[model samples]
Target: MILEAAMLHVKEGMEGEFEAAFRKASHIISSMKGYIDHECHKCIEAEGKYLLLVKWETLEDHTVGFRQSQKYQEWKRLLHHFYDPFPTVEHFKKVAKG
Candidate 1:
């Protein structure tokens, strides 16, 4: 599995709206090819900060399959505007698990 992680820093005062938009956007991603699951986590110490984690069967499942699809345009339309500096997404492969 490939783990995609992004540290989303939402625009100030738009946190609520961002979360709501994300809720709607989730469906778009969940329906994509190779999608396994995802999670959005709010930060405790910082406001307007979120951690987005998505599991995919392979790297291309996200970088190409999803990002290249029309659904990605909808995903971007729904949630891209909420970011400040724009999050950087990275992928990882499991090394060790408890």
Candidate 2:
């Protein structure tokens, strides 16, 4: 499995709206091909910061399958504007697990 991680910094005063939009946007991503699961967590210490983690069957499942689909356009429209600097997403493979 491939793990996709993104550190999201939402714009100030838009946290509530962003979370609502993300709740809607989650459906868009989870319905895509090769999607396993995902989690969106809010930071306790930092306001408007979030941690997004998604699991995929393969790298291309996200980089190509999701990103290239029309769903992505909707996803972008829904959630992308919430970011200030824009989140940088990266994928990783597990090396060890407990």
- State the lDDT of candidate 1 residue by residue for 2-35, as single tens digits: 9999999999999999999999999999999999
The estimated TM-scores of all candidates read: 0.99, 0.98
TM-score between candidate 1 and the true structure: 0.99
Report the number of the highest-TM-score candidate: 1
Assess the local accuracy of residue 3 in candidate 1 as a C-alpha lDDT between 0 and 100: 99
Off by over 4 Å in 1: none
Off by over 4 Å in 2: none
What is the C-alpha local distance difference test score of candidate 2? 0.97
Task: Write out the backbone clash pairs for model 2.
Answer: none
**Candidate 1 residue pairs in clash (backbone atoms < 3 Å):** none
Tens digit of per-residue lDDT, candidate 2, span 2-81:
99999999999999999999999999999999999999999999999999999999999999999999999999999999
